[model samples]
Target: MKHSICSFVICLLVCTGSLASAQQANPKYDKKLADSLKADAYGMKMYYLVILKTGANTTENKTTTDSLFKGHMQNIGQLAKQGKLVVAGPMKKNDKNYRGIFILNSASMEEAAALLNTDPAIRHKLLDVEIYGWYGSAALPMYLPYHEKVEKNQ
Candidate 1:
């Protein structure tokens, strides 16, 4: 029993030492960019993760639905342009009825909720949202510009 315990302790120590030595620093770290993105020491910051679920109301006619969804897309673009929304996309068919997700750059849940309310789909109950505080890379928005270059569709 004593021999096994000592072996386990030594193995744990070795792994811990290896991890410490393997840790690498970011050579490209930019203080100005970090400050602008409000990044912490680990290059992460807080944002809101919004889960768009199937709402209770699903009775809208096709024409109405089309208009609302179009408005919804417009609202998403507007929010992204305003820098209030960092990410947004729809999900595939699923059992949970999750419709889409949005990563919002808001100071508070209230602010996030208010931003969501602007969406025509959410406003009309075509979609409902579940908001959660999320910690993620502060550089998330930095990829948006690159996405434009790669996206084949306009």
Candidate 2:
């Protein structure tokens, strides 16, 4: 009898918990806004993912590499400012040929390649790039603003 009562109480709690959560509205939920942004559906779209790999000259020259990397950062900022790049970051502590990645706003591989070529690191052959078309949330473009809010030191 005691076990039966405990099981009943547990089931009641679980069902009520699920019901309460289902009734709660997400803070950012707005149907009109979503429709206005053309994200009413699954909000999936094609984007280019550029993978940066260790180049032939990646670590061959430290001084030149430092300068090229500085220019690379500048290029990243420029692309972000132009809304051409959705996200970019370097991989940490990896021994493989992997270096970094860029999620580009472009749908065309040619365009992505052209934009990537603008980087001094790429231009000077300090980094090699491979691009692929990816389908993901159209809401991804909205992430950067919210990301800036919680970022401490940029």
TM-score of each: 0.81, 0.71
Candidate 1 regions off by >4 Å? 1-26
Per-residue lDDT value at 12 in model 2: 100
Across residues 1-154, which tens digit of lDDT does each residue of candidate 1 receive? Answer: 9999999999999999999888788899999999999999899999999999998878999999999999999999899889899899999999999999999998899999999999999999999899999999999998888877998986
* Shift in Å, residue 46, candidate 1: 0.4
Runs off by more than 4 Å, candidate 2: 1-41, 58-60
Per-residue lDDT of candidate 2, residues 89-133 (tens digit): 999858777889999988589999999989999988888888999
Choose the strongest candidate by lDDT. Answer: 1
Record all residue pairs in model 1 with backbone atoms less than 3 Å apart, i.e. clashing: none
